[model samples]
Target chain A: MDNKRRKFLKMAGATVLAGIGAPAVVKLTSVPALASGSEQAAAGHGSGHGEEQRTGIRLGMVIDMRKFYGNEELLNQAIAACHAVHNVPEIPGRKSEIKWIWKTGFANAFVAQSQNLRSETVKNSQFPVLCNHCDNPSCVKVCPTKATFVNEKNGIVAMDYHRCIGCRFCMAACPFGARSFNWQDPRPFIKTYNPDFPSRMRGVVEKCNFCAERLALGLEPACVEACQGTGAMVFGDLNDPQSEVRKVLSEEFTIQRNAAAGTRPSVFYIV
Target chain B: MIEKTLKGKPAYWIWLAILGTFIAIGWACYFRQYVFGLGLTGMSRDVSWGLYISQFTFLVGVAAGGLMLVLPYYIHNYKAFGRITILGEFLAISALVMCLMFIMADLGQPLRGLNVIFHPTPQSMLFWDMCVLWGYLLLNVLCGWVILTAERKQVPPPKWIYFFVAISIPFAVSIHTVTAMLYCGLPGRHFWLSAIIAPRFLASAFAAGPSLILLACLVMRKYAHFDAGKEAIQKMTTIIMYAVIINTFFFLLEFFVGYYSEVPGHIHSLEYLFFGLEHDGHVYNNLVPFMWTAALFNFTGLGILAYMKIAKVFDYRLVGTAATLIFLALWADKGLGFVFAGFVPNPLEEVTEYIPTLNELGITLGIWATGFFLLTLLYKIAVGIEHEVEA
Candidate 1:
């Protein structure tokens, strides 16, 4: 731990002089913002393990809210594609606690972002929220039983429903409320069951899969297919430098949900 | 002699009739539950768990409280309870079976109960709770069966039986404490988020379970001519008195923190429970009545049990009546109204609360009937062995 910190400080000091410090070498840095490079470089002091993944394979999305057109169909298609294939149950009267995909209205969607904003008139912000599939999902950490686990292979949070005790502690820990419980037997609502996905039984929790099955088949998520070519939604490998997702992230500034949490969500919003 | 042994008593006929009737009702409800799904119940997205979950919670408490009997008999070696420790073990087995039945009825898929074990999520308290309960139930059932088999032959078996009973003491408490953790661990949800949740659960279980045992002893005297002796009942009642004191204290703690500091999430659930949340159902009406009843039950029940002057003259019939009423009152307080009140107006603050529909209530009732019917049969078989041992 001590060696890790020293390596970060040394690299951060050099970066301040390398590119960011050149223009500021003559200017007296009155404000930290003016010497942004120093701050950014200073942050590098405590981190280098991230350098390889940051440049090589740190996959992510860059969402741009300014260009959003309040396209309801586009949002629904994305959710449907994932839900349909996952065999997400739709019970009649009792809502069986399984949600592979879902949606929220625009006002509630942007309420957190623009509720306190004074100047910006944030309109047409029909944002879509999913599991966010955080790099450090708290749900996985608090599970005493480890029923919900993060798959290192695909960065997907997976559930072995058989292992879940239906105690719903993960549901309580999750700030997103993304998880749902099976309140009763789920079979009646299964109008169509997909054999591709291993189905969950009642009395356990279920949530978004992020299309791990589709990824294994070399196809994008079902939601991606529904939004394809519309330009409303973009799907690409964040790990690949040539991928469209990475290109968008560079061209436009985007925001992630609950940055304060430091979960490092893969999803992004462009506003 | 074989014909006489096979011949049933009048009480046996009555027990069989009652058990058969409930079993039939349970079967009908289960069929509909499978056909219509959870939609038949009063529960909605906001309130995913309702009456059945509450009953499960209550039964877990009842099951765990069996330790009071164990503590006296095994821990203290009280001879007054010597003839009836097996009865406590059997009661625990029945109560746990009820707990499992309630959980099954509440599940979206009754068959997928094994999923908790097959695809275990270590993160869920629900999973831990399941493990503890399964372990406790298996322990009790094994103990009861072993004792019944050995006692039927009119002799004590190997010494390992005592060791098994001793091990189950803490194991039973673990089941209920884990159940309490299921709620207390939530980040918010004011009504249940308390550090004292597990303690309160144990206290209530101790109060309610031992009270039921007192009633059980009374019934045994009346039906089977077995006297648990007044001294045993009196001693058990003292333990119940202390447990009630602790339970009421923790309950007060929950209310004080909720209303005094006045956090919104904390305050909302109380108001939702007592005064009713603006958009939610009439749980306030149903729950407030029972909350007061529970208060009355706990206070007066403890009052009667604690005071030596009043308790000396206490008839077993009156004790049985009061204890059963108190047991059911607390059951309603924590089990029924509490559950509906917890989730009504939900996290999103959508969806109003309502009593379980006829369908939902019927299904829940069906599950109870199923549990009780099974309990009756198990008791009948055990009691028969006890009778044989007495002879």
Candidate 2:
């Protein structure tokens, strides 16, 4: 009986370890560009710790609000693309609607920065705001169930809808108001169902997952891909200094939403 | 003694029936809400938390308020409070029930609430709140029941029960402190993210909790021929007066810091509550009247309290009126107003108005009915025992 009990415990430990370890191994082995000199050079921090370092990719976005100034249609298209791919519901009315990405005025977007003497174009610019996916995410920290967590592999904040208790503590904790709770069943409101992405139930909180799903598919986020020709939005590894997002940040005077809140938002706006 | 409540007068049955009708209506509304999801409520992405959360916050203080009476009787050995400690404990039990119910009603997925327990994250204050509230409830139930049992048998409560009393005092403070932490730790919510929140919650709880108990005692006296002593009521009034003063002071400190520093984020919610604010060419004046009414009642109640304190005369009518007003003042301040203030100029910096829908009100009313129902029944048992002992 003792031997059987020990054997059962050993199997359980192995299963749990395998559940966690298998993903790490798969992620490390799958990234073919791990040893590339350019990738290493771009990853300037170079806190290289062998196998684990391969998945130390910090994903971020650079949104150029200037390009979206008068083109409401362009902004809509990009938002729609993301919503469709992510299976975000369109709950008709504004109140209970689910939004992954949406437009906001420049003043509201860069809340901490001075908007007193901005040019008319800058002031009126409609910036697409979404989850900042903060390096030190407050939502991730406050989530009672660990339903929302920062992916240690890629630094992308991800949500497990099934696990969310719908407490909205994460919603309150989020300084940027990036998170939204599914106030009702989201499935019916979805215009065109995307089987690739799962629809969340009424009680879970969800936000811009930084397109972790598409990233796994080795494709750009729907928003980034839709804004391909326009170059209004760019998504790349922030860890990679040579990446497009990093380059944009380096060249442009970019400002993050609620920077003073010290959340260290990953999403930067080139106003 | 326990069976005595079952043999109440016709008036008792009528009271129960009224509460039951409200509960039935509430449950029916809740069923519809359960089917349709939280969409039935006026809560949105902007005003994510509304009436339910606000009530939960207020009621946590109410539950903690039991400690004010409990500590004096048990810890301080203030024998004057001996008669009413059972009432306070029962009140705590009922208030905790309402607090838990409000939280359950507010959830987007009520069934998944166990997720907090299954995946316990101590870093989250909500988890801590759940632990302390449940523990506090259990403590009150055990201690109150044991003491009552001993009273019936004409014996002092067992020595082991004293240990629970010692634990209950600190545990009571923790419940409200953890509730305050739920709001205080949030960095973005300038209205709630303050050091004053915990102390203010305590003060408000001390004032509102005992004010409510004092009123309940008066009602019990009128209905059940139970007098909790004039001296006892006066002692409670003193507690309420000092606590309300401190509560008012703490509240003013927030206004002072917000205005004096000239920080837009800090002052914006206060401005929205008091004078109203405009967003995108539309003005939100909905909460302005409510805030002013609350302030009026608070000061008027304070005035009455001061008069009574100075005159050295205890007038139940004036004290009762003041208590009722103070209760309403705290209710309005802590309930939807405080909750709504945090979301004003929401995360997106938009002042989208949130008015509770009828469906939401139904659920809230139902929860209140449930609390009152519990209170009435528990008091019936407690009062029956008291009557039996007196005879």
Candidate 3:
């Protein structure tokens, strides 16, 4: 090849190499900064409440079905408390509804455990279901953008509304049907907007965060606090054996929703 | 040269105008969808994916189907296909363009689409799908354009072009396979959780893709006076025939597994799709007619193609009809039947049937028109060049 041609080839090759390498280097350097930025955002949201940020905590919830079994009013109150605090919209239809926590028949809740000749109590009772914050959360596994993620600092399955692309891949992956998408603008539907929590925009997925913000503020989840005196809903650190959740889990004959799914849900029901 | 597309006949201009009108309407509908949100569509919380995603899945098959032509001609040294390999590559380019548009339309935060690139989670199947699809599109455009340019100049393509062509062969397979893995790897969606999904996707794509190419070739032969050789068309028909049989067989395997296992999780979605699941004394059977129609068309098309192969008499009219039937059948099967069926009983065992609204349909039609518009332009250029070479 002529010298001019060879020189042109070398320049083109270098240009191609630089084109491929430049973005990669930038992405690698930015990843840690982005991660820390998200961590700081998580911390900053819960920081001003004067509670020390806790780490090495696997937050868990236990619902004693015995207390909640026949109490429809109490269950509704618990659901209301969570929704009211979190600014979850009260959309009218099943299609566009944003539900953080909701009640369903026991058979529907625990499909595997339901027997053909089950007692009327088990069949008639309503179970309040929420995000299990599974140790192996399938939602987190499928999130292409890591918008919905398991908080490493505390095992709360959380949503970064700003980051969510609304692909709903997480919704398909979540065995529990815990995630809800903002199919439309959610603000108009919120009758009473809680200033403390941010309402999501249209085209993003939102779900129960196990009240990660509340937990950071040294407070129990809204649902757990709603049923505080009744001992129906218990929220605490599962990593701490002395914590109420672990104590209750150890003592009670508890079952998880779709245990066979192998997601290892942190939420359990005392049957 | 692309300039060839600019000076087409009145029919071509009229066709372009028609496509432009549909594209305009689709864009307007998409604007409404953007403003109103995905709630404007039939998709609910239960059926999170509907027409947009279904079309994306189907078109991915169409895009990958280009491999049927590329593989045989390049790997097997089939000289007959030499006349029309560019057509296959260009077809792939158009289909992939539609595939990407459908994905963009399906997203909730379409603007945040860059987040997929920004985050780059290797664990997510969607990430790999994005990678493979973009790579395949690039490879096809490069291979098709470079080769066609070389052919136009009456010279052999550069040695480097063959390297890219080889990469594109496997790259085509990966696009559809990765798309399948998007559904199959998910936990608890039993309808999509099978090992056969990738194979099934490939089988249907092979049938659908070449069926489209066959139809296009017949059209060009009649109108543009461009012939892709009789032997090449016959061989393609045989390939489509076997592909249709294999596609049907793979689907049946899914049925056998679902029915024989007696696993409610496995059977429920299939039942909901085909026979309508009864819930609260109301049967959800919206997709039943469509699925059955797909079955009918698929079998009928298969029979016709089989007859054509056996008789050794290729009638252009009959071939065109069979190709259309098979194309529509695969579209209904992969596009309509496959996607929402996975979401039918949902993860919670609740049945919520999806029926796309007018806005959704309009947008879908628009994307398809856009693809065809691109296809027409590309074919015009290719056929124009071929005519020049003949002259």
Candidate 4:
């Protein structure tokens, strides 16, 4: 080959290599850098301006079900608080019901790992499960429109109800069974309408936003606030090492709903 | 050309009236569903997809099945399929219409479904399925119309029509393969996760698609006095024989993989399908009987088709009977059994059974009637031209 051709080939090869390598290098380095920034945000949470201004903050919850083991009223209060705040409908039938957060047995919650030989207390426990708001959410991936998306700044899987075509691919794709479709008009079944949060229309999928609206208002999730008396649920930014969720993870061993699914669920349970 | 459909006998008019009544009833049911939402269907949070999706999956195969005829006739220059090529193409068009309607019926927000296009996401398989389906539909309409129009004028088809015919061969394969990908690409759904799904989809499509066309040909020969010829029927039978064998082989391969590997994820869906799963004294066996019926029909039809091929027998009655059995078998396999099988023992490891309500059935029947109505009219026009040319 001529010199000019060789130079062109080398340049072309270098361009392709740069194209592939740039993203990998950026991804590998960006996480740790973001971690430090979120730590600062955690320390500065008491400072009102810093908490609201920080980006790339992943808000998660760790629920200690044992705290409320005998107290069904507390559990109900937490669930009711979240639902009312978000305007989640209580549709009459199972076929068409919409739920953001609900309870399921330990066995049902963790299908991948074996729990057959566990104690009665552990086996019979009603664990409050919601959208894992995973680090890698399948629902966000399968949505045909950008109706469901992961916010890069905060890593919360968010939904745009207006843009959703209601194809329900996300419902099928979600392994956690976290998403729910609005089967009929939700207005009739909602006992007390929360005028603050807009009620969703029929046909769109809705799930626990981890109380994104509350987070924006510099308040903890409604469920977390409701559980404050019992101290069952702890909410904080997972990226921040100084955050309460990180301290809880450091101090105690906790398990996610389905670890093998590889969704990296934000919701952890300390049994 | 439209006048030809209008001139059919009293029997045709009666058929039209029957189809029209069902269409009307189906629309009335759909209107209720539209007002109330998909709550009217048997689908639940656990089983979000139901009858409409299953029918869509089955009809996509029927739509892609057109390639079996189009390939042999156009690409290979096989003269035997000359008469019925239009029939296959028109059959695809009708099936596609039903497929689109089924999708619309299944959507929670049919009105906002265009949001998929308004804000397209390449990451989602549904977007790709839509692209391929629409392209395939347009390709068939253009090719079928141009060729049929040329035939009526007593001239060779326009050169541009061949470009569409060539593109359609691959486009047809993509449509069903893309449809399979819609299910197969899902991460945790074990039943649809197999790599063999796309190939099996094509194989089943070939078996089901040609069988339906063959039966339609037999009906046309008897009723409309239009013969698709002995050579054509025998050739199509050979296609069905190989397709049925391959389809069965792929299905058995899945069973072997699931059973031998002994993986719980893979085995759970099949176990629930072939045998009922019991949880907390509640038994779910809705699909057990249906799955067994599908196996019986598939194997019996496979045996009959294989014997015909080996014996070199070409009895129209026997072939038509076998085709009917295979068609129904795949209808059960792809339609009733496969779609909801993935959702059994749903993600939460809880069983939620699905049984379509009467309203759902009415809508399904309406879609079928609408398909047949389109088929009747299109075939009537084609047969009229054939009669005119022969005379």
Predicted complex 2: CAPRI docking category:
medium
Better of 1 and 2 by lDDT: 2
lDDT by residue for model 4 over B1-391, one digit each (tens)?
A: 8889889788899999999999999999999999989889999999999999999999999999988999999989999999999998999999999999999998888889899899899999899999999999898889888898889889999898898899999999999999999999887688998999999999999989999999999998989999999999988988998898899899889999999999877887788788887778987888999889888988888888788878877788888888999999899889987899899878888889899999999999999999999999999988998888888
Per-model C-alpha RMSD? 9.7, 8.5, 13.4, 10.7
Model 2: residues >4 Å from true position, as ranges?
A: A1-55, A69-72
Instruction: List, residue by residue over A1-271, the lDDT tens digit for candidate 1.
Output: 3443233234334433563332222111112212233222121112334532222122244545443455666776777777778877776543544675566544333323444533333533456766766666767765655768776533567786776665454665554556777766666667688888876665577887666556555455677666655555554435434446666777878776654444556777775
Between candidates 3 and 4, the DockQ winner: 4
Query: What lDDT does model 3 reach?
Result: 0.85
Query: Could you arrange the candidates by TM-score from highest to lowest?
Result: 2, 3, 4, 1
DockQ of every model listed?
0.19, 0.60, 0.57, 0.59
Q: Please state what fraction of the native interface contacts candidate 2 reproduces.
A: 0.81
Error of 1 at B90 (Å): 0.5
After TM-score superposition, the amount by which residue B217's alpha carbon in candidate 4 deviates from its true location, in angstroms, is: 0.2
Question: Which has the greatest lDDT?
Answer: 3
The positional error of residue A49 in candidate 3, measured at the CA in angstroms, is 40
Task: Choose the strongest candidate by DockQ.
Answer: 2
Reference-based lDDT, residue B169, model 2? 92
Q: Candidate 2 on B109-207: residue-level lDDT in tens?
A: 889999999999988888899999999999999998999999988799999999998999999999999999999998888898899999999999999
Model 4 misplacement above 4 A: A1-55
